[model samples]
Target: MSQTLQAIYAAKRKARRFAVQGIYEWQMSHNPVHEIEARTRADNAMHKTDLGYYHELLSEVISNADVLDALLVPVLDREISALDGVELATLRLGAYELKEHAEIPYRVVLDEAIELAKHFGGADSHKYINGVLDRLAQSLRAAEKQQAK
Candidate 1:
């Protein structure tokens, strides 16, 4: 990638990493969203992250978590309660991006979510994340999927 594109990609990856952590904290502690964002920004190297996207993912995903969960629950093999915190947070972020971020390709969303699961969740959790998000993408990005074919 060109330097500018590379920078943007790195920043977005960093944003996803931090957002996943923030979402996990939100899920486990039920902390306020702004507080989580502030704490994450304070504790992390924010210079390299896509701060705006991080805020969007953290704030929007948490705010719409119930709806995201409702969409995800049907695709899951087990109950939402049975999922690990990391997997759940990653799924929520992925679901939000798939449903709301039309500018981002569905494949990119799935790949990022899989990466999050691999880095933060159990060894096999990426597979489950992949399965759920893949199904979600088919529904949410139906036209994009059709175009790709």
Candidate 2:
């Protein structure tokens, strides 16, 4: 891939990492998304992150959490409230991307969420994330998935 493309992907990955943390924090603290975003920007080295993408992911996931949870409900093996914090946040982020960010491939969303789970969730949470997001993609990105096969 070209250098520019690789840089874009790296920036997006940074955005995902920070967005997951922000979402996790919001889940735990009930803080406003803008407050979380401001705090994150102030506390972290976000120079390399895709700031717009980070903002979009953090804001959209938090704003539409109920809607995202509704989408996740059908595929969740257990109660949504029973989910681990990291897993819930990662899944919400993944589900949001699957449903709203059609420009991003579903596989990329799954991979990124699995990475987030592996980094921040309990052991084996990545596997669960993969399974749930895979199911989500089937429904939300069915056309893209069929074309990829």
Candidate 3:
């Protein structure tokens, strides 16, 4: 990736860290997602990692969460209701890139998210994540084609 895109990926790495932290906190507490979200953004220091891209990406993903979840369903074969909160969050972040951020190559986004899943999610989470992202990317291409026609 060029310098500009590299910065964005670095940001995504940062965002992933924050997202994981925020999601973990949400899991541990009854505190609303918004409260957790606000806290994450409020303390830029929480990112800890050098990547500002993470800050931007996490903020955008959380900001546009509804649409991101919509894209997530088709990619997920199992009922989305079955997914735990962390799995749900991972899928949404990966889906957000596949559907909305067309600028980032789909493969790169999926790979990064899978890495996050492997590190932070359940042991099997990466498999589930990869499967969903692959399906989501294919559907996104189909949607683009239909729109073009």
Best by lDDT: 2
Please write out the lDDT profile of model 2 over residues 12-81, one tens digit for every residue. 9999999999999999999999999999999999898999999999999999999999999999999998
What Cα-based lDDT does every candidate model obtain? 0.93, 0.94, 0.71
Off by over 4 Å in 2: none
- TM-scores for every candidate against the unseen true structure: 0.97, 0.97, 0.70
The residue pairs that clash in candidate 3, if any, are: 11-53, 11-54, 14-54, 15-54
Residue 94 Cα positional deviation in candidate 1, in Å, after optimal superposition? 0.3
For TM-score, candidate 2 versus 3, the one ahead is: 2
Full-model lDDT, candidate 2: 0.94
Q: What's the best-to-worst order under lDDT? A: 2, 1, 3
- Tell me the RMSD of model 2 versus the true structure: 0.9
Badly placed stretches (over 4 Å) of model 3 are 1-8, 23-34, 41-56, 142-149
Better of 2 and 3 by lDDT: 2
Of 1 and 2, the candidate ahead on lDDT is: 2
Q: Write the per-residue lDDT of candidate 3 for residues 4-36, one digit (tens) a residue.
A: 877656766776767766654644574666677
- Give the backbone clash total of model 3: 4
Q: Summarize candidate 1's per-residue lDDT along 54-116 as a digit string, tens digits.
A: 999999999999999999987889999999999999999999999999999999999999999
